[model samples]
Target: MILDVILDALLDTAKLIPFLFLTYLVMEYLEHKTKNKSKQIMQKSGHFGPLIGGVAGAFPQCGFSAAAASLYSGGVISAGTLLAIFLSTSDEMLPIFISESVAAGTILRILGLKVVLGAVSGSAIDVLWRFGGKKRREREEHNHIHREHHEKDIHDLCESEHCHCENGSIIKSAFLHTLQITVFIFLISLVIGFCVELVGSDKIGYFISTKPVVGVFLAALVGLIPNCASSVVITQLYLTGILGAGQMMAGLLVGAGVGILVLCRTNKGVKENLGLIGILYGTGVFWGILIEMLGIVL
Candidate 1:
């Protein structure tokens, strides 16, 4: 069982390489080439970030949430946008649904719901941030950094990731960065996989399935695992009639496809990270409970 867990973890981490590499490639290009225009646009379109993040994160790709974490750490995007991406990220849910031969319409509905909720939750966070005036200092700092030495800002991010490839060719830099994060992700996935194996998914499913009221909270907790297995377990439970739509979504919404892992490692400040996690957990539970109360079947 342990060996199988290791192998499966490796295999799952391997699947993320292409998307991760491509995301880094795009980041490199933006940093090296379109830094000016992209910065201008990113700032100008800041208000729409959550909406855009929701759309991008809802795609089948696994790296948007990870990339969003890096962007947020660099102060390139707001926390609301990061939360939006995390909430909407589908991780392994779509692939599992397709493999299980689930109805296409149902899949679409779930994806759509996630995207909408992601945007709504993100926008709300942003509003609260601005209303509380907590966003002023960060925005000013980001602007000052950009006005004086933008390249250093980008390099600072590279330093955070410990890639130090900022001075190299864009392709080389991107590759090194990708490899660094991929290794970190692999280690995390391996540990989580081994733990899950020990605890046993069957036992987990039975517990949550039997207790509907408590399941939302527990399901959201499961979603916070920061691995694909969270989605796999949640989806499997729902398909087996052990979890309803809202309960499955609670897990899925919190399953940000390793985004949480990246966020914790790359982003600074433990308290801030904890706060974001709290917000994300609250959002998932609120939506799940609301959906259940509405008796909305998907």
Candidate 2:
């Protein structure tokens, strides 16, 4: 039974391998297009850009975390946008759409819900940030502005000897590197799926669903762990009918919102964007409730 579960999980991950590769390519292209644009512009024009990013991201089956990394590295999108992608997209949805777990109708409903929620959350963050900036500007105008010591240009400093490169070469390198990383991620996801089966996702899921408050806390905690491993457990919970759609969605949404936790840990500049992290968490919970309520009502 364990062997069969392992093999099935492996196959599922294999199916996502190509998707991960493609996501990297598309994200690279998006980075290319937005390269010269100001961060302020992305921050101000939050709705369309994030909505597009989320919807396009949701269509793919995997590697959003990798795409988030690429976006952060390229500086095309902010941490909030990355969280939006995570909140809304899922690989398990594709399989569930085809299997007995969730219908195509359910998948569509979920995707539509994701798009709306992602856009709204992103817009909310941007609006708050803009308001904060406006207040800061007002204060600076009224009071003497404090100046920090000038630092050397960041571009003059380099992380790697090969960090600087022509656009074409950089894009090609990012593509190849993303593909390689995704292949390994696929293997890891397969292994996680096998373990979930061995432990009995159904039993574990029931325990999670029985307590709403605990379930909410657990969802947030599970989200703190990086990678696709949590999805395996969550998906099983959904499939076995152990988890209500509300609880399962809450966990998954929370997982997506904090993806920048991984990005912030890895990148310094991204750490400055930690303010967006709270927005992601708040929005995740908000929509989680929304999803849960909707599931009950409809």
Best by TM-score: 1
How well is each residue in 184-255 modelled by candidate 1, as lDDT tens digits?
999989999989888899988877776665898889999999888888899999988889877988888888
- C-alpha-based local distance difference test score of model 2: 0.55
- In model 1, state the lDDT of residue 124: 96
For each candidate in turn, the TM-score is: 0.88, 0.68
Q: After aligning candidate 1 to the native by TM-score, how far in Å is the CA of 122 from where it should be?
A: 1.4
Model 1 TM-score, 2 decimals: 0.88
Give the clashing pairs for model 1: none
Query: How many pairs of residues collide in model 1?
Result: 0
Which stretches in model 2 have alpha-carbon errors above 4 Å?
1-46, 133-168, 175-207, 257-262, 270-278, 290-298
Error of 2 at 111 (Å): 2.2
